[model samples]
Target: TQLLEQSPQFLSIQEGENLTVYCNSSSVFSSLQWYRQEPGEGPVLLVTVVTGGEVKKLKRLTFQFGDARKDSSLHITAAQPGDTGLYLCAGGFGSYQLTFGKGTKLSVIP
Candidate 1:
C-alpha cells in the first residue's frame, strides 16, 4: 500500500505572505498532481509533475517533484485571502489509482 504524508496540516498567514506545503512518501509514483478545493466545491487540479526535478508554475503558485519521485512541494508567493483553501497532493501508482495525502488547509487573512 502507498501512503502519502503532508506536513504542517494547517497554515494561517496574512495576505501578501508566502507559504510552502510538502508531501512525502516511501513509495515511488508515476506522477503526482496538486489540487485546490474551496468550500462546497470539488478540488481543482492545479498542476501535475511527472519527471524527477520537474517544476511547474502557475501565477503565484509553484510545484516541484522530488528528484527521487517520492516527494513533492507547493509554494505560494504573496498569498491572498482568495488563496485560502484545502490543498492536496495525489500520487498515481501501479493500479492507476491515486493515493491522496491528508491535505493542507490554508487560511489567508486579509
Candidate 2:
C-alpha cells in the first residue's frame, strides 16, 4: 500500500485568507480523495480525483490532481471560520485499501 504524506500538519489563518494544503506520495495511486472532518463527526468526502491533471472546484475551494497521479492539493479562497476542520487525503490502492495521510488541522479564526 502506498502512503500519502500531507504537508503543513497544522494551519491557523484569519478569515478571508487564502491557503493551500498538499498531499504527496512516492507511489502513484489509481485514485485519490480528499475529506474534511469536523470536531466530532466522521470525515466527509470533498472531492475524488481519478484522472491525472484533473481539477475540481467546490464553491470557494479548489482541488487538483498531479499530472502523475502521485499528488494532490486543496486550495481555499477567502476562507471562513466555518472552514475550520481536519483535512485528510487518502490514496486508493487495491479493491478497497486506502492509505490516509496524517491530515492538516486547520483553524480559521474569525
> Which lDDT tens digits does candidate 1 get at residues 1-110?
68999988999999999999999999998999999999899999999888999999999999999999999999999999999999999999885889889999999999
Local accuracy of candidate 2 as per-residue lDDT tens digits, 68-107: 9999999999999999999999998866889999999999
The alpha-carbon lDDT assigned to residue 64 of candidate 1 equals 94
TM of each candidate vs. truth: 0.97, 0.97
Query: How big is the RMSD of model 1?
Result: 0.8
What is the C-alpha local distance difference test score of candidate 1? Answer: 0.95
Clashes of 1: 0
